[model samples]
Target: MEDKKRVGIWIRVSTDMQVKDDSPEHHERRARYYVESRDWQVEEVYRLEAVSGKTVMNHPEAQRMLQDLRSGRITGLVFSKLARLARSTKELLEFAEIFRREGADLVSLAEQIDTSTPAGRLFFTIVAAMAEWEREEISSRVAASVPIRAKMGKPLGGQASFGYKWHDKNIVIDEKEAPVRKLMYEIFLDCQRKKTTAERLNDLGHRTRNGSRFSDTTVDRLLRDTTAKGQRLANHTKSVGEGKQWITKPQQEWVIVPCAAIISVELWEKCNAILEEQLSKRARKGRISEYLLAGYVKCTCGTSMYVFSTAKKFTCKNCKNNVKVADMDEIYQQVLKGYLNDIEPKMYVEELEKAIAEKEYLLTTSTKKRAQLRKKMDDLVPLRVSGDLDKEHFAAIYQPIVAQVHQLDKSIPELQAQIDFERIQLNSTDHVLKEAKGLYESWTKMLFPEKRAIIETITEYITVGQDTIDVGILHLSPSSKLTSQHQFMGSWKLPT
Candidate 1:
């Protein structure tokens, strides 16, 4: 039998009048009825009552809904209308992107849009494309003006570099900060280490403009800026996305605005030369992993084993235990084949689903109990206000209820977290099962890197004993996975 689609109902009412006319409960009921018509289960309800729709992506309820969706606790979201989901076009596009990436669905009743349907998917594509076009249009207009402003030596919409400030529409050195900036170059030249320079500056009680302790990255960025040498470069970089890293633009597009020099050009060149040499030396020593389980293998003595240079055996530094690389590889391949063939994903997922359902039920009953307790507490307040109860009586009644509510508050979240964790396991097992058959078929033909990638994906660790090899297998979703750092028992064992 096919599993019923699990979905969350979204309810956001911004105003008291809207609550009176439309109501969060009314919206939730409408969404629930729609879900029921399709035989989908309403797993959760995110209520954002009296919250602004203008920017709800950061709201606690919205975050919880997203978390549930991402963790696979729910696979879809149902709202009364698109506006209830989000009024902002950008946020609407973001929601669609997230749903699409997670292989989930979005259903809006009033708009008659369901991303599970072809027509609804088409509607989302069109809306997202239009939003992207609008954003690009605005971005291009801004980009066109940046070079002109840079060439004219005008402020380009951000604060000047740390040692300099924008004064009267001109870039000038900040007196107090310039000395510290110059000292950074001096320290780097003496020590030839960016980390050392940062530590020395921090020890001298110098901090960044934001008042944070200087770090190696901060020191490196300050050292690399050409503004210290008087030629301030602008329009040299472009951001790939919101909150993402910026990459260097084409050199021909760069604009250099002349500014006051902090240090001599000779000193700047010498410092950068040393940095380039150090980077080159590090790059020369870098090498790719030659063995399939280079990092995953560990000695049973609780130490990592590695194949030393010109050695064919993975040797443990602590216990002197060793295993031939080829033998270990052979054992791993046999283990991999058995592990992939042995996975009973359906049975495993059923167990996880049963656990999740139990936790969800517990969370629901606890929430209801808390609400009832809260109502009782509210009623007691009115009794005291009306002088129907004495202060001692009110206290006697309120304290226990408050204690029960607090306990429930803590327990309910714990239940929900357990549900979220099991749902992640359920999703990960599904993903690995779907991929395992193909991976096994292709394993013989895959190159070292390809095979290594799969090992990193499914393997928790490999422990090498004197006469036995044990492998721990854990298939985790890229978005949510327990770290292998936590100890896990081996799932496969072989006699050496």
Candidate 2:
């Protein structure tokens, strides 16, 4: 084991690792010095560039080194600094354990530490903690910076998205994609007229970026997205829960560069409003019955019970339960009305309005922070002229601070756009509530079969128990599995 000639060299560079100065050359020279002093023959040097030192697993070079260790090919691993290998103490200890188990040594030239020593392990614990802190500080510093550039209508990311071209200061609209965007709006109108949807367009044959056939999801994204018109997407809020993701309509969150506008803002808003209106109507009317939750309810078998009536028998084909259509319909209607009465939609709207106002308040705080960061960065200009602070420190402090200002710059505008989006939704929700209020009275007067159609449109699935029923209403639009269905619990025995 002592006579083993296999050796591994791992090299990593964050953006600053390689400089015009002797920093990188010094790192290489020191590494080579140790290799020459010891008779360890050069096997493989894994060099990773433009990567961060914050994550040990993510770095390509580190991954390669670990792979060689697992393969029993590496007798030893060498780095200049412990930070070059890991950012966290926990991760450093993991590597230490791996090397110890493999009968291999982990050594750093700068720290003069090796895994063979108990002292080296202690040194690593301290180095890893510092590295972790530095990584987190850099992250917060970056988060504080991006909005300023976005606010100025400057291109922050490397390139533009699908429908726009990146210019020096702003993104120009791509004329070719703009027409296809307009077509998306027209298609939604056609769907309303035919009482059909873009789902057919997908089935017929259309392919998107992934080479998969077009789906209703693709059409839905196009209709809801504001970006296709060469405008920024509004209220692009992202939330992750239970390892699931949800991306909603582009609320009013946008940084519209006057120079970047390709489609009129009015036109963009009009397209979305039209599409939303048509979808809501279709989802309610399109279902077979007014059972609001028709598609939503699942049988014990996990299959959906079909909402169908043949002659006087209402049956779940999967469950084989023959129910009276009139009785089931009445039960579903009563369940829905009961749940709506509990909600007090008007009160819900008021709560949402207050929440939006708080976000707008945060926007002001963000704007003030940006002003401070910008003013501080400007004060550094005099230091740059007089040489009080050298150019290097100036850049280190100023560059990151400037990025902070840019990020702050975009935050408030994005928040304001969100407030606008929520306002629109609040209004729509109020209107929808008004519509829901009349449902019970309207349902009683309609024909049993006609009422059935209305029930299926609003209800996703109708689940019947011995003396109880679960009616799920399709609160969201129809042509979408994206609809919101509120489950209404009710007993067939009416309240005295």
Identify the leading candidate in terms of TM-score: 1
Summarize candidate 2's per-residue lDDT along 1-496 as a digit string, tens digits.
5764567777777776754222454455445546544556657777777666566675656777888887978778766677877767667766765676566777675455654333445544554466556566775786455556657776655445445676666567667555554555566655643223455545545434455654566666666655655556422443332222555535454445444544566766776777677677768544345443345455444566555655444445665654455565455555666655654666767888899789868977876777688779779999999999998999999999978865654444445445544554455466556666776767667776766566555555555544445555665311222222333343333222
lDDT by residue (1-496, candidate 1, tens digit) is 9999999988887874263225565566556656766678999988887887788999999999999998999999988778988989888888887787688888876666677654456666776677668778998989989999999999987889989999998999999899999999999999999999999999999999999999999988999999999999999997764234599999999999999999999999999999889888888555877898998889998999999957588889888888778878877887777666766767866877788788778878887888789889988888999999999988888999999977775565445444544454455456556667677778889998888887886788889776667787774332333322222234532323
Number of clashes found in candidate 1: 0
TM-score, cand. 2? 0.33
lDDT of each: 0.79, 0.59
- TM-score of structure candidate 1: 0.51
Which residues of candidate 1, in runs, are more than 4 Å off? Answer: 1-49, 57-145, 162-223, 240-243, 259-288, 298-304, 316-322, 343-428, 444-450, 460-468, 475-496
For residue 44, give model 1's deviation from the true position in Å.
Answer: 18
Minimum summed lDDT over a 10-residue window in model 2 is located at 476-485
